[model samples]
Target chain A: MQTKRMTFPGKWLPFALLAPQVIITLIFFIWPAGQALYQSLLREDAFGLRTTFVGLENFVRLFRDGAYLNSLSVTVVFAVGTTLLSMTVALLMASTVNRMIRSRSTYTTLLVWPYAIAPALAGVLWWFIFNPSIGIVPYMLEMVGYRWNHRNSGSDAMLLVILAAAWKQISYNFLFFLAGLQSIPQSLLEAASIDGASPFKRFWTIVFPLLSPTTFFLMVVNVVYAMFDTFGIIHTTTQGGPAQSTNILVYKVYADGFVGLNLGSSAAQSVILMVIVVVLTVIQFRFIERRVNY
Target chain B: MVENRPWANFFAHTVLIIGVALVIFPVYIALVASTQAPGDLLRGTMPLLPGSHGIENYKLMWQSGVSTANSPPAAKMLWNSFVMAMAITVGKLSISLLSAFAIVYFRFRFRMFFFWLIFVTLMLPVEVRIIPTFQVVADLKMLNSFAGLSIPLIASATATFLFRQFFMTIPEEMLEAARVDGAGPLKFFKDILLPLSVTNIAALFVIMFIYGWNQYLWPLLITTDPNYTTIVMGIQRMTAEENPQWHLVMAAVVMAALPPVLVILFMQRLFVKGLTETEK
Candidate 1:
């Protein structure tokens, strides 16, 4: 909230400067959010006629609904799976690349570009790789007598989406992990090594603890990414199918409202997702504030 | 580095090599698939190496996409994607710069309320309230147009915050000097602020370009017309066909992915700066 010590002399100029963003935000973001809130409290009969007020009934029903519960659990699993897989791999690669003097930038250049790939494209790439009949992985899996069909199997479909989502995220996490590693005082690592500890022991005891802030920040971010941003990944690959196994909450909102025409339920779902995002954003900002002091 | 252990160095290199290989594996397969003849991809005979049909497949998709999918040619889709991305990047940057300049440079009434209103955009992503947003767009008759594709998405809380943070670092004396020199608010903003923001703008340009180019669901929801189908969503339509031609699809995928990937490679420093500095 700090402003310039010296100020610009303006009454309407500032408003003019802020108009475009404020207008767009109001029209696009605030208005729709308000509409969703209002609509969540109302309901209509099956033929889009005979409306009635239903306060919290949609939310109450969603908790009792089997599909909604499944979507919630699937979101948790996908978020945790993506965060863990990408962070672990990125931490490993970051630590290894942190050691190399000459090859660090080269390795980084190779690893970082995937951050640019669309989630939809990443899904297609992995979907092709895991294609049952023609994919190389499935062909290899068959030699070991394991079927890899995602089209008919829920678990396989889940795994396919998870891998695709995690793959796109690794580059983003790696850059953060690398930055975190670089910021750690090398003197501490050198002193720990001089204590006759092995390299692995030094990493576990010293480097790992120092990277917690970055780890926590990335964890929240990855969760948000998995929950909301992976819509494209799921849409392109699974379409929440194999019996709605990969139907995360965001997709469910779209599906239920737009596809199922269940307006009240979708509005309620949207409100819930908004609450979750607000909570996560607050948590992320809180961690960032705490990280500054550390 | 503290110790001279050769084995440790070897282990590090091995891990990095394997990590890089895993990262590159899917794209490599996509590349190989694009180069293969259509028949080579079926029956578990997918080749490990590139085939002779690379040019043929890319040319086919670029000229006339797979007819079965009813998707437009890659050339048209890529052009659409470029226009959408540029519109979004330019829109986001210009609006955010102006708003941040307003917030930082002026003392005004209801400023805090306006700031919080802007902050609300972060709470509800396009996904959560997508239905109502779609309805709004429909009522406004923005469907299947560039205005529908980019404008709603241009109000960025992150970019505004980024510019605010950067503007805060500018020495206050610079503003005082401008004021003393008889430079008005618009004069200072146009001459002084724009030049100072060039680097931040370039950095954010890379990130926003990718964001706009890679959009799938928004375009999918709004633009039912094939004319406005972005490359990202267009490829999805291609694969949703009854008989997907793997060769042409991969070719389309490669083309769709190339622009943003190349942008990152070329402006890596700026992209990384924009990305790492972006979060909260």
Candidate 2:
């Protein structure tokens, strides 16, 4: 609510200035969200002809549905898997890159451009690379006496989607991790080293602990990303298939609504997702405020 | 230096080189596959080296896409994508700029309410509210048009907040000077504020261009016409076929990814600066 001390005097001009964004927000965002909430409470017959007001029935039915429960757990596993894999790799690369005096930017450039690739395209690229008959990965796994195929195998399909999702995200996580690494005081590391501690010990005892804020922030962001933004990756690679193994909640919302034509159920799912996003956003903003104070 | 650890330096280099290679591997495979003939991929595993069919494959994709897939040629799709990305970027920047100017420069009633209304949007992604939003757009008859492709996706809180933050850092003296010289609000906004905002605008433009270009689901929901197909969405259609034309698909993927990648490479400093600032 802060503003300039000497304000512009206008009766209708400020209203005019604010009109476009507010209008678009209402038409596109708010109105549809309201509709979703409204539709979640309404149930229609199989003919789509008769609608009955069934308060919280959709929500109750969804909790009792097996697939909905499966999707909730699938989302948690996918989000956790992606966050752990990408953040670990990113932190390793970032801390190592932070050590170089020269050639640092070269390595960073080589790493960061992957962030620009669309997730769907990234998904396709990985899907091709893991194709059972022709892909190099499956062929290599064959050499190692392990069979790999995502077509019939649910777990393999899950793994494929995770890798594809995590691949492009590493670049984003790496950049943030690198930034976080750069901000740590070199003197702390130097003193730790001078105290006869190994570099590994110094990192765990000082650097990792210091980087907690960035780590926690990235964890929230990566979770949000894996939950919502990964629709493209999942849709492209697995289509949440080999028996709904990869159907995270976001994809399930689209699938059940559009493909399954279960409107009330889908609307209830959408409402649930909106609630989850709101919770995550609140956590993020509150953390950001706390970080600012520290 | 910490006691001259030669092995450690070598170890760090090894880990980083491997990490970088892994990052580059998928795109490299896509590039190599794009260059291969159909028969070349029929062998047991994909070739690690480039094949001779690169030019023909790219030409075929750019001029005419896969026949069975029914997707338009990459040329049309790329143009559609460029137009869509440009429209969204311009639309988002312009409206957000005006709104941010109003919020920061004026003491207006209901300003806080408007700000919070916009803030709530950050919580509601298009993915979550897909069905009803599609219904709204369908009701409005905006489906399959460039406006439909861009408009609903543009109304968010990030860009507005970003502009507002930038406006706060701007010196108040500039505004005072404009006022003392009898310049009105619109004139001051146009002449002084717009000039000072070029760098910030350019930075946000780079980031938003990539964002708009990379959009997949919203476009997928609304745009069903072949003419409206973006290269990103079009490539997915190609791959979804019974027997995906991998060669042509890879070529289209490369084309789809090229512009945004080039933008980031060229304007990396701005991209990074804009990204860091906006996230904060």
Candidate 3:
């Protein structure tokens, strides 16, 4: 709420300036979210003719609904898997690139372009690589006596989606991790090295501990990303297939609402997702506060 | 000085080289696949090298898209993507700039209320509110239109906050000096503030353009018409075929990915700055 010490004296001008963003937020964002809340409390017949007010019935049904519960668990596993996988790869690359004096920019450029690829496109690329009929991975996998088909295997489908999601996200995590690594003072590493510690020991004892803040921030970001943004990855590749193994929460809302035409349940799912986002945002902001103070 | 070990440096370089290769592998495969002849991929495992048909495949896709999938030509789809991305970027930057300026420069009623209202949008992504948002578009008759494609996605809390943060760092003496020169608020904003914001605007433009270009779910939901289908969504359409033509599909993927990737590669400094600062 900080403003200039010398301020503009205006009434209508301020309103006029705020109009465009406020109007768009209301019409597109606020209004639609309001409708989701309102509709979640009501149910309509399949014909879209008769509507009955049902208080918490949709919410109750969602808790009992097997598919919704499955989606919740799938989301947990997927978010955790994506966060760990992308962050681990990104950290390795970031730490390695930080050590390079000559090839640093080249490595960063090579690693960072993937951030621009759409999640759906990333999924398609991985899907092609893992294609059962003629993919390179499967061709190689067969030589090791293991067949790979995402279409029929639930676990395989989940793994494919997770890899695609993590692959696209590695670029983002890498940029942040690299930035984090660069910010660690070189003097600390030098001092630790002067103590005759090995390179690996110095990293673990000096570098890794300092990078924890960045790691934690990326964890929340990666989780939120996997839960929400990977909608494209799942939609493009599996469509939450192989017995709903890959159906994260956001995709389920779309499938149940748009594809299945179950308005009430979808609205309820939307409300749940909103709550999840709110919680995550709060946690993110809280961490941001600590970061600022530190 | 720390002791130098040749083995440590060599190992670090090796790991970095391998990591960069792994990162580039997927797009490399897509690039190679895009060049293959139509039946080359169907015959066996995909070719690992460039084919003689690269130009032909790209020409076929650019001039006429997968006709079986009902997608428009890649040229048209790329145009739509460009227009949508520019619209979203410009819209977000202007609106966010105005709102941030208003909040920072003026003492107004409901200022805190409006700030929190914009902040609330940070939590509600379009995916969560898919049905009702689609219905709003449908009701407004904006479906299948660029306005619907861009406007709904442009109310950016992050951009607004970024501008607000930038504006606060401007010394109060600048505004006092401007006022002494008989400059009104709008003139001060135009003459002084706008010049200072060029770098921030450029950085944000890179990030927003990529965000707009890569939009998949929103465009997928709103634009059902083949003419409005973006290349990103067009790939989905192409691959949805019972037996997707891998050659054409990879060609479309390459086209879909090229502009944004080029943007990043060319304006990497701005992109990196925009990304890290925006998230912060």
TM-score of chain B of each: 0.98, 0.97, 0.98
lDDT string for model 3 (A142-176, tens) is: 98999998999999999988889998999999999
Candidate 1 regions off by >4 Å? none
Q: For residues B164-230, could you state the per-residue lDDT of candidate 3 as single tens digits?
A: 9999999999999999999999999999999999999999999999999999999999998887898
* Clashes in predicted model 2: 0
Cα misplacement distance, residue B239 of candidate 1 (Å): 0.6
Candidate 1, residues A1-294, lDDT tens digits: the string is 888888887899899999999999989999999999999989989899787998989899999999999999988888898889888898988988999899999999999999999999999999899988889999898889999889999999999999999999999999999999999998998998878888889899999999999999999999999999999899888999889899999999999998999999999999999999999999999999999999
Location of the lowest summed lDDT over 10 successive residues in candidate 1 chain B: B37-46
Residue A235, candidate 1: Cα error in Å is 1.0
What TM-score does prediction 1 earn? 0.99
Instruction: Give the alpha-carbon lDDT of every model.
Output: 0.92, 0.91, 0.92
Off by over 4 Å in 2: B1-3
Q: Compared with the true structure, what per-residue lDDT tens digits does model 1 show for residues B58-158? A: 99899997667779889999999999999999999999999999999999999999889888898888999999999999999999999999999999999
Pitting candidate 2 against candidate 3, the one with the higher lDDT is 3
Candidate 2 C-alpha lDDT tens digits along A29-142: 999999999999999999999999999999999999999999999999999999999999999999999888798999988888888888889899999999998898999999
Score residue A140 of candidate 3 by CA lDDT: 85
Candidate 1 CAPRI level: high
Q: What's the residue-level lDDT of A151 in candidate 2?
A: 92
